[model samples]
Target: MPIHGIGIDILHVPRLAALIERRGLSKLASRILSPVELDAFCSLTSQSENKRALAANERGPTEPIVRFLGVRWTVKEAAYKALYPLRPTWKELTYTSFDAKKGLKPELVYASLSPDTTPAKLHVSASHDGEHIVATVLVEQG
Candidate 1:
């Protein structure tokens, strides 16, 4: 299937961090996230198993985790933008995972639900340029 929509977004990490701090994860999660999305976010932010695995590598825990979260956040925003033309409701979309098969190459996994449709495939990609994160979302109807 051809892509239904393309979306790109750029975000500043510090700004997003401040928003999350002020509003709390639950609020943000409820507003913009699904159960799978919340799980993915928390896994990057608070999972000890993933943290330990990442820490065992050379880049250490903190920086990698921060970058991972930033990329995930950007992907979420990109996914939202992609779905705007179709679903339009944030509650209908959810991200499942963000995986870096190679450095700076991320694979975003997500699911979208809408009336009259079962679920569609949502793909997201993220990259970092200096202090900003950039993401691209592609939605395909099946």
Candidate 2:
């Protein structure tokens, strides 16, 4: 396999938290995540509703919610970078889906692909510490 490109992104958790604080999760979700990703994020965060209520005050936010949004943000940014040259603008590119096939493993689906090129293979990896979220993407071409 030939390496097409690689991209990596690191995001501060608080930045996303602030955005969510200002824009609200629903609005932010519409901007950044696809319907599938939004659904997954909702489900994941909902699992912690009790904890969310305890952690949340009049302002709405919980750790899981922040991290989930952050991870999605970072991963999408990295994927955009990896698709360099073909660098479609963020508005032109959309993460069509994210499926957690097993455990925490996620597969990315993209919409509005450029006509000239397509990735033969794609790999994504993501991690989050309490403070930051990081994601790396590797693209392969035949």
Candidate 3:
């Protein structure tokens, strides 16, 4: 196995907030999140709605959704960069909790489409700042 590529991306939280305000959360999320990711995204959004109805969270009513979108956007973008020539659509890549791992893992649903190259491993890390999120992806090809 050899290292295929590495990618890093940083996103401002407010940019995602603006996107939500303009396009709405569901619309943007559906376009970016795979089915498994979408389920968790839906749960996050649904909870935000309920929280808003009761009272806005101190951070803000849309805080949770904005953070969710920001993290996903950056992670997917980084993954796309790491994949290089073999571009994968947002819906084709997903991140979710698997096994008893400490954090989530990435899955390339379209991996089968590329018969020659197999992603032996995908090392991912994501972090959030006050109003920014960053993600890094390390790709190993087998």
Q: Rank candidates by TM-score, best first.
A: 3, 2, 1
TM-score of 1: 0.61
lDDT of 1 by residue, 1-142 (tens): 8777778989887776666667764466566655666676566556744546543333433544445556666776787677665544554554444436643434454444435654557777777876788988888876
- What CA RMSD would you report for each candidate? 6.1, 3.7, 3.8
Indicate the TM-score of model 2: 0.76
Judged by TM-score, which candidate is best?
Answer: 3
What's the lDDT for residue 74 in model 2?
A: 85
In model 3, which range of ten residues has the least summed lDDT?
Answer: 104-113
Steric clash pairs (candidate 1): none
Those runs of model 3 whose alpha carbons end farther than 4 Å from true positions after fitting are 54-61, 97-117
Backbone clashes (count) for model 2: 0
Tens-digit lDDT track for model 2 on 1-142?
A: 8888899999988888888888877778767766666677677666776555644346676777777778778887998888676664444433333456744456654554567666446688888877988988887763
Q: Write the per-residue lDDT of candidate 3 for residues 27-97, one digit (tens) a residue.
A: 88889888888999878877877766634334443766777778878987988898787777788777653
lDDT of 2: 0.70
Rank all candidate structures by their lDDT, best first, as comma-separated numbers: 3, 2, 1
Cα error of candidate 2 at position 13, Å: 0.4
Global lDDT of model 1: 0.62
Q: For model 1, what is the error of residue 50's alpha carbon versus the real structure, in angstroms, after optimal superposition?
A: 12
lDDT at position 7, candidate 1: 87
